[model samples]
Target chain A: MVKNKIKTVACLLLTLFFLGGCKKTFNQPQSNPEAVFNELWGFMDKHYPMFAIKEIDWDKTYAQYKNRVKPGMVDAELFSLLNQLLFTLKDGHVTLMSATDTATYLGFYKNYPLNFNLANIKNNYLFNDFKKAGPVMYKIVSNVAYIYYASFAQNISDAELDIFFNDIKATKGLIIDVRNNTGGNPANAEKFFSRLINQKTLVKYEVIKNGPGRNDFFEPKPFYISPNGQTYAKPIILLTNRLCFSTCNDFALYISLLPNAQIMGNPTGGGAGLPYNYILANGWKLQYSATYTLSPKMRNIENGIQPNRTINFEPQDENNGKDIILETAFNTLSLE
Target chain B: MIKYYSNKTVFLKIGLSLVCWLAVVNNACAQTLNPDLYKWTFTLGLGLNSNSVIDKNFSQLPYSGNGLGLSGSITYQGRLIQQQLNLTYGMATLQNKYYNSLYATYFTANYSPLFCLNNASNSAFKILAGPQIAMQYARRNYSGFVNNNSSFEFSTSLATSIEISYSIIPIGLVLKNKIAVPVFSYMQQPAFGFATFFANSGSQNSVKNSSDFLVPNKFYRIINNFTIDKQLAPRHKILLSYNLDFYKINTIREVKSIHNNLIVAYSYLL
Candidate 1:
């Protein structure tokens, strides 16, 4: 009986040990203004990657914002404080989403001149005679093929690429306009670049945030653009403006790499980092850039990729239904 | 000369030792065991399950949900050995405090062949111990983030399993408890970001980059099962069970998950 009792006790002890050994406690913060502020600041302090690049002292920012969060602060008040905190980052990809309001920072493009006019291009240039091919609108004028791709959100399949290239095969040069294209899937950018490169080209580098430290990052990896689908070898001009962001910024960087291509118009809106979402204790969501893309020379493209030739769109030209940027692209393509 | 031993070397040595020990024990206990008795049983189970996960690659907050689970197992019991194969699948809609929901699904399968110990004892206690091989595939779909919306984990583990049963003759009931702890595992999770920019050979490289052979120090898992069974007829039995599973992976980032299940099963003697 004593031996049996010993065995039972042993079993009970083993069970308890196993049950308690691997358990972990989750510390979700309390739903209060101060807690929410601390949580947001703490999360960003760990996960945000561009503190040094943006030249913001986060600890100092925390000090400035911490005392503002009161015990009885309303949600809107708290949201405004957080918005002010995020605004200092000067990132186009950052947004604070709540049930009632979505706070965004549009300084990358909103403060700049709106350089693109779609009505002028349709009426004055294409004369409303552009042909639609899948996700792109194209027109041929004076042996120059003009393709207007408004956004990368829509995919251009290989078959569609075949049709697009076949229709523009007879042209001497091409003008690919992506003005006001904020962003979309980067895969579409890759697909579009593949057709432009004749050989595999090491286009840029990419790095991810690996640690919580301000400077902790993985070694930069090479991003290559390989030749795929229909190849286009004619002189190519990529039009851009401050409204070109995210994948459009990537498009600008890619077009600059080709010997046969040049980027015209203003600098692209810089949103070079990949954005990710996080939730706070109060159920509000915060989205911020988690990974950053680097140029082939390992330079930061966060402030926007500058054009090969800067050409400002004259406001007077808009009154006459004339797009000077488009006119410049035509002149540049003709010179090529 | 200084020799450096890696985790892989330690795992191989320990695994070999366990295999040799099992062989010796099996041979030693063979003479005392009856070889004529054999039985086969098939079991189908329905359960209510709940799980919580914190995948740091996506978010640090715990997302939890409840769902129904289905499990099936086939057991072959002999005089000296018992082998079983079990499969389970579950689906859940996990939510956070912010009401953002993520749909999750997981499937698990394991096979274990245990050698019976204390079979000749008259103390109303029976014990079985052996090694188990288990595989789990789990995926989560969250639309809250672009490029990081979906993530999946595929892992295979080699675990040590132990089972103890106490039979009550007067009440015609059996109480059994089983525990399995993984000693070594091969886990495949997503990379730092769900997908890297222009990853060579496309997007699947994220899954390939995060695959690693890990020991218990890096990845820990435990499965605990308890059941009370009563025989309805000579060829039928009903069981009520509670199972708990927990696992944590400690890499650059941490991912922890816990599951609790309450199950009802019917066994058909075959």
Candidate 2:
């Protein structure tokens, strides 16, 4: 009986021990901001792909900025960090612009420029490189010149551009191809427009700067002039597509202002903005819109520069070997 | 009188022989039965309170106040595979003067396979491996001039763990060494993944400098434990355990080491 009693006591002790071991006490909860910062910093140190180019001392950066962050530093601080990080890419194509700003920029191109069609050669559209020798460039039997400007970047010198315009002035009609031009500088488009119009008129007004900063001024700029010492006087057609954007749309708009110019093809890509850069506390950089532009008549152009004569480039046209839009332009010019 | 006495002695001897035979048979039967062939153990544990960055950044600060944690588990043993199921529930309050308190809870299910190293004793050493699925729920409450607000969040996760354990019946004690590791889907951030991994890995030095943004500052501890369980009755058991967890944490925020922290818990099995 005594032995049995001892066994019972031993079992009781063991059960008590197990129950005690599992008992837990809760601790008070609180926010540790320094810990939070360190955690984030450590993750970026190990996982960020562009850590080398970013050239940031994560520890020091966090330590320095953590103190400055007071309570209620939520979305504003997050946006600042994102801006800093994206600026390191340094690509013009990469940027942040509000939807409203983008809309405003597109609206400036709608009323002024004309659009037209350019001939396709060897499956390549030639609007920006009409001078390049290939099956892409073919002079028609009517002595009409058809040019495709793929991009505004094709550096056609001012003198060479004038000579090309002079050569095409007497043709039955001119087809300025901008089907795929995304855009570059508005000045380039203005120069091309000058060759088609005789009137020296202000096509757009720009405010270079606001406030008491340097180079702040509001001025009207002459958009087009006859460079051959005479206007084309004949019908000039501008071609565009959805890929036509930025200064390319500006070109279409400016050219459309001429009495003899007509816009053909699809709508332009609506993106217009003058970008400015800002640096964040973390040494990251970001670019955003700083200004807006408008046509001379104060019309908004954010939606896109619409074509005067809407023509669809059908898939069947390619299979049938017919330049439907260009032929329509020619027939219209011939009637005139 | 002589005849009667002789008959009584024979009867006594016969009874003695029968009793001895029964004892031998019982001993043999006990020896033949394998203890390792089948085992069922139930465990209950409680964890101390903690806070995380997700709680701090998205939710209000002091996301959890002093709170209690509860967990229970059942395991089955086979020659090569051991199956286990676990359930856990925890609640904490967010204690702050300015912000209102918050509550959080989690539930998990796990399946593990056991690998035995020896077949010699009823008490043997085994390794366990398996995956676990978990669901978490959280709630927040606010008061004062800023206006009262309450919100709840739900999430699901998967985890894996490896554990080594020894059961010895002579001393009526069982010792366990366990490690847990977790892998997360890409939709979740890597910081959270690292935290989950470290929380289960049971590695003190491995995750000392780990940048798991989601883990609370107080959780950076490596837990090493020694446990003693004694069977009180046929179905009742008592357990006594002590654990030392290493924590190394920012001292400026709280007067504590950021690593090598320690916590102790005790439980009874029914």
- Model 2: native contacts recovered, as a fraction: 0.00
Model 1 docking category? acceptable
Off by over 4 Å in 2: A1-120, A123-140, A207-230, A279-285, A318-323, B1-270
lDDT of 1 by residue, B104-175 (tens): 888888888887665334455667888999888888888566666777777899999988777665777877
> lDDT (CA) for every model shown?
0.81, 0.45
Stretches of model 1 off by over 4 angstroms after superposition: A1-28, B1-36, B76-83, B111-120, B129-135, B154-160, B183-186, B195-208, B211-220, B232-236, B268-270
Residue range A1-336, candidate 2, lDDT tens digits = 645644554564445434433433223333343343344344333323222223545556666666754555554454444334334432222343322221122223344333332333433333334354221233433666776666765545567666666667668877777766877645566566666766666565332222222233234222323343556667778877666776676677677677778888777764433433322222122233333345667654433577898887567676565566666766776666
Clashes of 1: 0
TM-score of chain A of each: 0.92, 0.57
lDDT of 2 at B217: 39
For residues B134-223, could you state the per-residue lDDT of candidate 2 as single tens digits?
333443433321111232333334445555555565676666554333343111221211111221111122111122222333323222
Q: List, for all models, the DockQ compared with the true complex.
A: 0.26, 0.01
